[model samples]
Target: MNHEISNQLKQNQDIRENLKFLAENFSGKIVFSTSFGIEDQVITDVIFSQKLSAVEVFTLDTGRLFQETYATWDKTQIQYGQKISAYYPNNKKIEGFINENGINPFYESVNLRKQCCHIRKVEPLQRALKDVKIWITGLRAEHSPNRNELEILQWDEQYELYKYNPLLHWTTEEVKDYVTKKGVPYNVLHDQGFVSIGCAPCTRALKEGEDFRAGRWWWEDTSKKECGLHS
Candidate 1:
């Protein structure tokens, strides 16, 4: 972490104040990626409702997202009147992979699944972060044990930029309360058992007492399930 900037961020009284500081100082170099989850919706509300245009907001469309996710996307744009940018995987690469290994080979093995994630989410994210200095994500430590090791603001050597997890310390209850009070639009799947939603085929609503990430890649071993987007 850059202690100077990190200290400056800590000086802010709240997330909005910190975001405003960044907007005023690092305008045009910051970006936020959302998936319409409760946590992401909170960030979107602040960035859009507050009209913090300095931070570029976007999503990675894996082309396999649930219809409910799409509906939430539309409602968010309509309510906020801000067009969230979209990034898709490279056509040639996806098409070539599909032709060579069938459309859903990711179901066959972990290696295949990772390849799919790299092509669909990671690659597009790489393109999205090009020339970007700060990458914002609605990551909370409670989401997974892996995230428990991350700081709210830190340098990501993988992306060659600073990563900001504004809601890192926030609990699930706090995030839900923020969304409801702010009237931020969110995915309906959350009303069911879906604590974490992603691609349609890859994600499922959690059963009882399951880990946050179990909703995604439920077929894989419980060791660590990441899409390569976050580290």
Candidate 2:
């Protein structure tokens, strides 16, 4: 991490205050990527309700998202009166991929799934993050075992930017409590056991005691489930 960002991380303040500090100092250079999940909604509430003008908010619309996700997206806009930019996959690439492979090739193999994610997510994410300095996320340690090693603020060499996970230490219950108290717009699928929501085809409701990320790409090995956007 940069020494300046490290210093800011050492402040030990609440998420809202820390986010305010980052927004003030890194004005026009900060960006938040959301997927309309509960944790993302909490951060969206903080950014919009606090009027964090320095932050740019965007989402990758993979064209395979659930109808509920779109509804939550609209509700979020209505609540905050702010537009969250939507980034789409390149039409040419998508067409080529679908023509080369089947429309649902991801179910064939892990490599195919990763290829789908790369086209629909990673590529668009790169475009969304172009020239960004600080990338804020809704990542929580408990979301996945892989996320446990992540720091609250860390350097992302792939994007060449500082990544901030303001909700890094927050539990699932804490996220829900905060969202309820703040009246943050969230996806209703959460109440139906969809612990972590993603593109519709790749996600499903989890059974009891399953990991939060288990609902996403459940057919793959646990160690190989990331969509490459965060990795």
Cα-based TM-score, every candidate: 0.97, 0.96
Worst 10 residues of 2 by lDDT: 4-13
lDDT of 2 at 155: 88
Each model's lDDT comes to 0.90, 0.90
Q: What is the per-residue lDDT of model 2 for residues 20-101, given as tens digits with 9 covering 90 to 100?
A: 9889888888999999999999989989999997899999999999999999999999988999999999999999999999
**How many clashes does each candidate structure show, in the order listed?**
0, 0
Q: What are the per-residue Cα lDDT tens digits for candidate 1 across 133-180?
A: 989899999989898999888889999999888899999999989988
For model 1, which pairs clash? none
Any runs in candidate 1 off by more than 4 Å, and if so which?
A: 1-4, 11-13
Range of the 10 consecutive residues with the lowest summed lDDT in candidate 1 = 4-13
- Tell me the spans in candidate 2 whose CA falls farther than 4 Å from its real position: 1-5
What are the per-model C-alpha RMSD values against the true structure?
1.2, 1.3
